[model samples]
Target: MPKDYSLLSELADIFKGKAVPAKAEPGEVAIINLVDMTPLGIAYEALRTFAADTKTLSPYLLEAGDVLVASKGTQHKVAVFEGQEFPVVASANITVLRPKEGTNGHYLKFFLDSEEGRRQLKAADHGRAVMNINTKELSSIKIPNIQPVKQSYMAQRYVQGLADYKRKLARANQEWEKIQADIERQLFL
Candidate 1:
């Protein structure tokens, strides 16, 4: 048996990001942009931390289960934000979806990463120069009401799969490096 849900907004608190500066200064909170989210996950290498009053950013601050959505970009990517080194919030171009009680953020993340979810996001993207999906549009997107146990199981599988893939990718890169070194030695020495 399956349950039907009208839209994602019903299950979560859908909101847009705040205005962020072009650059961050020292002693400021770290902000997440669309560029920070990659296919692998959130890349913390090029973080931008700028000084902003806590009062202004406190509302936008991300919780551990909060999900970040790319509102303005070529790709529609979604990531679940667990706590990082410092306080982090999504930029104006990203949409934040904080799951309501009885909902799993990781499960929602996996669902939003699915093909159907991408299609919904694509349909909502309405911008002249860049693709954009606003809070209203995101909220209006339909979703299935999956059971809690199943959702958790699915989310766990997704996490495990991602970990396995990363391990394999690292191994492949190491092997390729070794092969390149061997070739270099054969040609030079």
Candidate 2:
């Protein structure tokens, strides 16, 4: 039998409030937007803007473990911030959900991306043509009940995979640079 999951509202008491107001400007930190978000997760390569002073932007500053869901545009793109780096900012189209203490952010993120979670998002979706999720509807969505340990394990695996891919790309670039250097030397010699 599957474990029972509860409506996100049940966990509302966990989150203190919505995102904080920005006290700085853009470029102060990495900014996440709907364009930057992809089904696979945050598309780091797609990220185009940064907040110079995150303090100036309201609801843009992000902390570790914050789940960013696209509030506007096409539904289904969601991303989670694991806090690997600091000074990250979220876009207005992205609503940030901070799980209550004790709950695993990775767990919540996975649950949100699951089939059931997507169904709820589709159901709560409003607007006739555009389709969007208001904060109230987003907060009321349901999340699956999974063991925190399992959540951590899965999250770690995903993180490691991404890291490995990044490292491989870096090595490939270095090899290409060497090839280019050799060609340049031969051409001049």
Candidate 3:
């Protein structure tokens, strides 16, 4: 099928994350440091809470649908910020991409996770020790200008498929363990 495309900047607001250095306190908002980010999503287990007041970090605070992309290290690494009980924000080295009305956050993430998307992003990487992607370059990246209904359909299936795969994998592991146990019992007998 023929596909339409547009510059990412046209469909979303792309900006760098905050640089607050304070560690999160017990009950404050969680801070999504570069260390907390993963290839496909944010590592909630690795997130550190911010110690400062939420007001001080208001602008950097993330909403549930925001997409966070790495500006340093692995350039195309991205994560979706699914809001939790506590609030969250991205670190300075990451970029927060908030989709506008025309764009879908999940679809954007899926595209960025694709091989073509990674290739384009990596091709734009620059710097010595640590590679980086600036907002200018990141914004210029092309994305599919798909219809909202279509985008939503694809995104939902992609998410559901992942959940189904994980469920099947867990069931398979349980079956394997049962087989192993049965074999051991038979051998002992």
Candidate 4:
């Protein structure tokens, strides 16, 4: 461990997600699964739902600034749960990390997504059949001990840049679709 780095356990409370039974109908609780997570971010549309009383699943219920890291998988995806209007919880495959008040949750997610952070996580992987990083190993991962304010500022800048890029990508995709439609019409004519 580097002198400047601190173990993630020192900064956050780690909790393994509970498996929730699924429901056929649209339900009150949203499940954040591995499929819901992506390199860009969590795919809100990919989230599955289950019927459950929030009171019973209180421990799994996501709070604002909670970081959800994939426990079992090759990617070991990391995402921040920004707290929704309704109830949401991570699925069994995810390990929820609740950073302390002074720690920036987004910064933790960003760090875990970085090359150095990914290397640490990869080194921690030990499961045989299904590659996984256990809670204990994840808790021991090292991260730079940065002030919350500074972490927040840096995270916000990265977020803003990403959002801007996404907007431009969407616009470009729309233009490409329009061109495709024009070509199809010309072929038919």
Q: Best candidate per lDDT, number?
A: 4
lDDT of 4 by residue, 64-155 (tens): 88999888876678988877877898988889999987898888988998899999888778887776886788889999888778898988
lDDT order of candidates, best first? Answer: 4, 1, 3, 2
Report lDDT per candidate. Answer: 0.84, 0.67, 0.80, 0.85
Model 2 alpha-carbon drift over 4 Å, by segment: 10-29, 44-60, 84-86, 164-189
lDDT of 1 by residue, 1-189 (tens): 456775788789988888876855766688888889988888876767888887878889888878899898777789988777578888998999998887888878877888888888888889767887866888998888887788778778878999999999999999999999999999977
- TM-score-wise, the better of 1 and 2 is 1
* Stretches of candidate 1 exceeding 4 Å from the true structure: 1-3
Number of clashes found in candidate 3: 4
1: Cα error in model 2, Å: 4.4
Model 1 lDDT at residue 3? 65
Q: How high is each candidate's TM-score?
A: 0.91, 0.68, 0.82, 0.92
Q: Pairing residues by index, what is the TM-score of model 3? A: 0.82
Best by TM-score: 4
Instruction: State how far residue 69 of model 3 sits from its true place (Å).
Output: 0.9
Model 2 lowest lDDT segment of ten = 12-21
Query: lDDT score of model 1?
Result: 0.84
Clashes of 2: 16
